[model samples]
Target: MKGRESGMPEEDYWQSFFDADGVVETLFDAAGVAGDLVEFGCGYGTFTLPAARCTRGVVTALDIEPLMVARVRQKAEAQALHNVRAEIRDFVSQGTGLVSATQSHAMIFNLLHLEQPLALLREAHRTLHCGGTVAVMHWRSDVPTPRGPSLDIRPRPEQCQAWLYAVGFTDIRQVDVQAFSPYHFALLATR
Candidate 1:
């Protein structure tokens, strides 16, 4: 549940937090998704729309917020996208379609800050297909900053790298994404 105090319209305010198109552009161009694909913390089709444009496989866009799911569904319908599907499921508590039926790849943006980054990484590892890429996007500094500088608590690139390692993610790579203004960073952790 997105607490009312969060002070943002679930999509209008929250979707603006990231340059989803830019990040998804990077992922698509980088050959990030090699198999079944999904996105964690997908809000309002921000990243989901672009991701849907690129991949031929099914793209399961997930979020914990039901309103966010509805908003994303509206956007997807407005855009006439048939490939992307929105669902409400906690990334850790529910199936991510990463491990259950089969292993899958995922792009997790701006989600790790919600809970322990290490636990998410471990779950990502468990659900992802072999050689899957888990893209983690967050801010560059944990200190007070302009972008996503929330008590909601986001991690810097260094912390993401270290956490990925701690969670047993191999071949960790951090990249600066210029798509999101105010400078957002993304880490690619593969198993």
Candidate 2:
């Protein structure tokens, strides 16, 4: 199923809001994002290519939109990034088709405002091995952002942490991503 509308801006406009490579480096370095990684909503391959460069293992990038999946695939091919696997799938409704406990890290960036936040977290939990990390990022509600979901639906950092904890994630700590994405807050949790 499609997720709740995030008020996503046009691709270029949305892309302008983040320094994708820098944000990826910061979050991945802190979370030890190695081995195979799974990215939820790999829109425009913004983070997928950067992540592929970081890990030796495959980067499984899933998105519900076929255009997004195709875009990621094209970019990966153009860059000769043989490690990326871009697929069109509704990961929110159907869990990621990865073997349980097989992923080293999962990226749930800017997607927590969905209808079932816990369900998504649980899926991430189910797919990750023990000690595997999940990185969560979302727009900060306190600040007026250029783009994001409605303020009422936007989750606070504490709420995201609580959901992570509820799904059995540990070592949950906020990471400073303001340098790259000043409008967003990031959290890293271990499964």
Candidate 3:
């Protein structure tokens, strides 16, 4: 199924909003993101390529848009990031198509505003190995941002925390991402 539109900006404009490398580095370090990682909505591979570099195991990047998936794959190949596996998949409805308890970490950036966030969080919980972590990032609703979904639809950190708890995630804590992604907030939960 096609996911709800996120009001994603143009590629270059979207890219300008983030320091992908710094955000990835800070979040991964805090979450101890290692081993195989699963990224939801790998738009432009902004985080995917950097994530692949951080882990020895594969980075499985799934997106509903074929163009986004293709772009990610192209970038991965150009960077010779052999560990990246970019594929077009409706992960929200079909799940990640990964073996249970196989992934060490999961990335769900700028996506919780979707209609069924708990479903996606459940899938992330299902894919993670015991003690594995899931990182969630969303545009800050408190401040006006250059781009992002409408503030009315954006989920707050507290709301996201509740959803994570509902999906059987533990050790939920906020990670400060202001230095790298000033317009966003992040949370890390363990499964």
Cα lDDT, all candidates: 0.69, 0.91, 0.90
TM-score, candidate number 2: 0.97
Q: lDDT rank, highest first?
A: 2, 3, 1
Candidate 3 structure quality by residue, lDDT tens digits, 18-108:
8988999998899887799899988888889989988899999999888999999999998899999999999877899999999999999
Off by over 4 Å in 3: none
lDDT of 2 by residue, 31-102 (tens): 887799899888888889999998899999999998889989999999999999999999877889899999
Best by the lDDT measure: 2
Q: Cα lDDT for residue 122, model 2?
A: 94
**Model 1, range 1-191, lDDT digits (tens) per residue?**
43222223445666666677777777556645755677777766677888877776778888877987898788778887887778988766654655542445677776667555566677778777677777887655634545464654656777778888997788888666765635477778777
> Which scores greater on TM-score, model 1 or model 2?
2
Q: All predictions: root-mean-square deviation over Cα? A: 3.0, 1.0, 0.9
Lowest lDDT sum, 10 consecutive residues, model 2, at 2-11
Candidate 3, residue 8: CA error in Å?
2.8
